[model samples]
Target: MKRIALTVSAILLLFATAEPKQKKAQPKKQEATSVQQEAMKVLMSGFSTDPRFTWKTQQDEAQRICSQYPSMEAMPAQAIQKVIQLSQADLRYPQWGIFWGDWREGKKIVENPRGGRFASYGFSDSPTDKGGNCYACHLIEKGMPGGTMGPNLYQYGKRWNITKENMNTQEALERVKAVYNIIYNSWSAFPCSSMPRFGHNGALSPEDVMNIVTYLLHPDSPVNK
Candidate 1:
């Protein structure tokens, strides 16, 4: 009993004399985040702006959220819905109830890729100078070769049953509106779409978009042939 008491006392004395352990400092995660943000700012500042190609340094809410996650699959359903809602809110419809335009003009825009690009920085921001480059990712024309990045849009109007006869019908108009929404901000229609937000990103104007709609939906368009 005495030995046990002495051993306990010795243990207590040793503990009392021992110094407290200090915790090692953690790596500063926020510091890395700040540095990453600053680096992006610096990179963005390197680009000079022109009339058509303005250097956008900041990300919008949808972009921010999308960037935070690698892909839409990495994001939750709520987050995906949030991006869609934000894109939908910013959608700008065509003015004066004019949804369709000259399909010939639309074909020109679709065939050309140099329009409105940074490469065309010095040129005027005219419709003739800007292009949708739709052929880069879609097979719009039947025999013409196109990129396979996007789906084939051959006979798009025919598939939708849109023709010159019923192009002015209420249902056709609704279809036009749907197409406009898809082209304006594809993410609005599909939250995880890889398609570019042509209107939202300022790559295409309202008039340009309407013309593209015509190219895809007009009965007289070569796309329908």
Candidate 2:
């Protein structure tokens, strides 16, 4: 309870002083620092690890901030800065230069929900035990199905100027970067997003994410078609 109190205190303090709308230029004026202690305190207070699975350790710097300052409405300016810096620095990119794959397969990944990590899963789930679970957060397809935690992604390809011809062009690489950051660091994109850090954990592999990117950019894919 005391730990929670301290955390809650920090949250309140940060909020009591931060000016939200005026933060348009926040990124241009922030410094880097570690928020590990604060994050650990919050995690230990709210998380319990069963014998089967383990409480994920906060490794990435952005995670440390998210774990601690779970509420953006209460995140300190300094902490937010740290989170952005870490996310931008550690974005995981694909190795084979294959950012796009079969969008058909990607759609399946985003819809799956049976592979979340749990303590009863033996400390760690299999590497392949991941899901894009995008539908849980965004209005993806036009009339198919999806969740509303994220904005609609139906015309994502069109919004990004993706077409049958340029879906595989150099422009595709830039799109991949944007998508990667969105998955790995939602806060980096939207300071108060409720989206989970899919890449920060084992929820989605770089390969898996590439497929989703393809789903959004591939011309023949339903998103573009």
Candidate 3:
């Protein structure tokens, strides 16, 4: 009876201390949330409510879910699957199909460092000024200076064993399709990836994405050489 009474006393003391600590933690969490909201409001105040800018500020369903976590590794399995499902559902392919486009055009898009950027000081992008700016994230060609944010793509086609001899095979076509899907919507392959959903966001047309895929995977392209 004496030991049982001591154990009960310990439990009661722990509850008394923990309850106050939890109550104190609640206000801190609310304060942090309020600060974050205020910071976002301040950031949004700089941009105009124009239709072009509106899309940049708005979060879609996938983006909303992604924002809840700091990184993909931290995301729960359910959230990761949700993001993948959303990305796959949102994919749009070229009307011509998933065949590779002109690799030359793809090279230009990959190398060009211009795209949909907005600035109030006469630096806004025109509707026709579209580019993939792929070099900013990946090393596409040999000896090219590119950011290390994404994987090195030099000799990507050779690395994949893609060649003219087997280009027409069903396996080759499936590989091409997989690359196309990643370029169009990276989240389908890697949920909450740092890579942008180029085609899904209309940043790149289906034709443009196919061209990039060709540049990365075509045997004759400099990327393979």
Candidate maximizing lDDT: 3
Superposed by TM-score, candidate 1 places the C-alpha of residue 38 at a distance from the truth, in angstroms, of 4.7
Candidates 1 and 3 compared by TM-score, better number? 3
After superposing candidate 3, which stretches have Cα over 4 Å from the reference? 1-37, 116-128
Q: Residue-wise lDDT of candidate 1 within 25-127, one digit each (tens)?
A: 2344444445455555554454566534344555678876665555677788888989999999988876766557888888887898764453234556565
Backbone clashes, each candidate? 2, 5, 0
Candidate 2 segments exceeding 4 Å error: 1-52, 57-78, 118-129
lDDT, candidates in the order shown: 0.74, 0.64, 0.78
Residue 219, model 1, lDDT: 90
Q: How many pairs in model 2 have backbone atoms within 3 A of each other, for residues 3 or more apart or on separate chains, i.e. clashes?
A: 5
Candidate 1 segments whose C-alpha is farther than 4 A from its true place: 1-28, 49-55, 115-123
lDDT per residue (tens digit) for residues 86-166 in model 2: 666656767776567778777777777743443124455554455666777788777867787678888787888876677
Q: Which candidate is the best by TM-score?
A: 3
* Worst lDDT 10-window in candidate 3: 116-125
